[model samples]
Target: MSDFYIRLYKDSDYKVARQLFNSGNAKHTKKAFKHAMRQPHIWPPLLALLILPALDIVSFTTSIFAVVGAIVFLWFAAWRMYWSYVRLCFLDDMLDIRRYYLEQDGRCFWVAESGGQVVGTIAASPSSYPGGENHVELKRLSVSPSHRGKGIAKALCRTMIDFARHRGCKAVVLTTSLVQKDARKMYDKMGFRLTHNFYRPKPFTKLLDFKILFYQYDIPKLQ
Candidate 1:
């Protein structure tokens, strides 16, 4: 951790930051595939497809096509799910961090550097969630896969929390997925409390029980 330092995001950090963000999001594709497979709705169709062949109701060749089709569909669905999020991020704040964060008061983006290379990123902006106008939202908190367990994330989070405090924010809020267990644990350890547990409203996401967790850390009032 001593080898790393955190600083305000700069124009030169764009390439490495985008790479880190894309890779971080891409790593979840496997998890999404597994999650989709575990759904009971998914297994019912697969089981029915297998049953047809076992009962000789369908030719073995047909069964092979059915099972392979199911697998391929699931893989493609997972790929779309992962890339959809990446595209959304690019269309949103990541598309121009300086415009969304740097140019606004009570907003900022930071990167963690080690030996002149970007290893992590995080950003904070005023919240838009209901009843949270005075709160800050933490976003894009990702650490390089090779750089985990070294306190970079915590350092980045601490920086955001302090930034919120200085801006006189009432609290800090953020959203994450259940698949991000390490991040969930880190938020808990940092005194952030769960505020909402909900799934995305998309049909497949709801059917698969994919959940999004919201958390908030209340800032103590200054004397």
Candidate 2:
């Protein structure tokens, strides 16, 4: 821990950051996928299988085709839901940190390095909150599993908060899944209040009941 320090992200850090994100996010994907299976997307197709029969909408041959279509719909929904989770969690804006966070004004991206090895990362970007341009949303907080409990994550988080304070931001916000109980706790311990708790991304997330919790740390309050 003495050797580790948090610093601005570099092009060279991109690969390791993406790798850490993928591996760290794999287990959560299962949780998200399971919740997705319970979404309305999957339910509609199943309901169609029952409704089409009750309505007697077709002849025997047509009914067979209808059943097949319903099955395909179910499969497609499952695949789509799972893929959405993957894209949302893995194919993130961190993939292009320069374009997404670095080049933009009031945005930042950083990585934690120890012995010249990037072991953790975090990023911040201006929030869209009305009249809150000074506010930032923290993103991509991750620590290498092999390096857990070494204080790298806490250090990275502190870096983001310090960066926000220097930037004159009002506060920093972040969102995490319910599956990330430890992360939520860490944020709480850091004085970030759970501002909102809900299933995010609207209709899709609503059906899955995929609970996402939002946290916010007031820079002035912390200081």
Candidate 3:
């Protein structure tokens, strides 16, 4: 069997990473939009109400107020929701692609062909803790769809764990949405246990309708 190699991400890998991200995004964006529109307070009835005023079928003043109210509500709601979705998408792209080339925190890795074709990637950064005890956070991990079912994610995760250990981290932590069942299963199999579940409503994570699961695993002492 040909061995797959993993290494640090390089500036040259950005193009392939972007291509992979766009392809994956195209597969899910429409469904995500539909899901967002179905939220109880999102798609309020506006056009049907607008006709009430034009036909003078009701008190004009009351109809005007109702129409204006609905328009304002929809505008504000859609503004909040769409921007949130955009931020979340940008956050993923930043962590997955841009940060690698920019070396934002100087911590990221890539898996690729020896001849230099990028196939998978994993990125991490030091945690925001003091006392020389760092918590490594896996920011992103992705494999080409064609490369799935070959243990790439597992190998990438193991590499990250080893890297964190080498850097003297006391523990490693990561968060994934409950919707990502396969990823949750993989993390569980890797000995990471769920530590918390909480809502993340930041503009950069709008599409994550459910609470996020935080997982943690203590680094074993080296013999």
**Number of residue pairs clashing in candidate 3, backbone atoms closer than 3 angstroms, sequence gap of 3 or more or interchain:** 1
Top-TM-score candidate index: 1
Question: On residues 186-206, what C-alpha lDDT tens digit does candidate 1 reach at each position?
Answer: 999999999889877655566
lDDT of 3 by residue, 1-223 (tens): 6457887666677667656544543444344444445556444455566667678787777877987785555444434543454457567645456454346663655555434577777767776434325788875577778777778789888888888888877888887755567788999999999987876655524432444788888999888
Per-model TM against the reference: 0.94, 0.72, 0.64
Give candidate 2 misplaced runs (Cα > 4 Å).
33-92, 202-204, 221-223
Between candidates 1 and 2, the one scoring higher on TM-score is 1
**True-vs-predicted CA distance for residue 117, candidate 2, Å:** 1.9
State, as a TM-score between 0 and 1, how close model 1 is to the true structure.
0.94
Off by over 4 Å in 3: 22-106, 114-116, 129-133, 202-209
Q: Indicate whether candidate 2 or candidate 3 has the larger TM-score.
A: 2
RMSD of each: 1.5, 5.1, 6.4
Ranking under lDDT, best-scoring first? 1, 2, 3
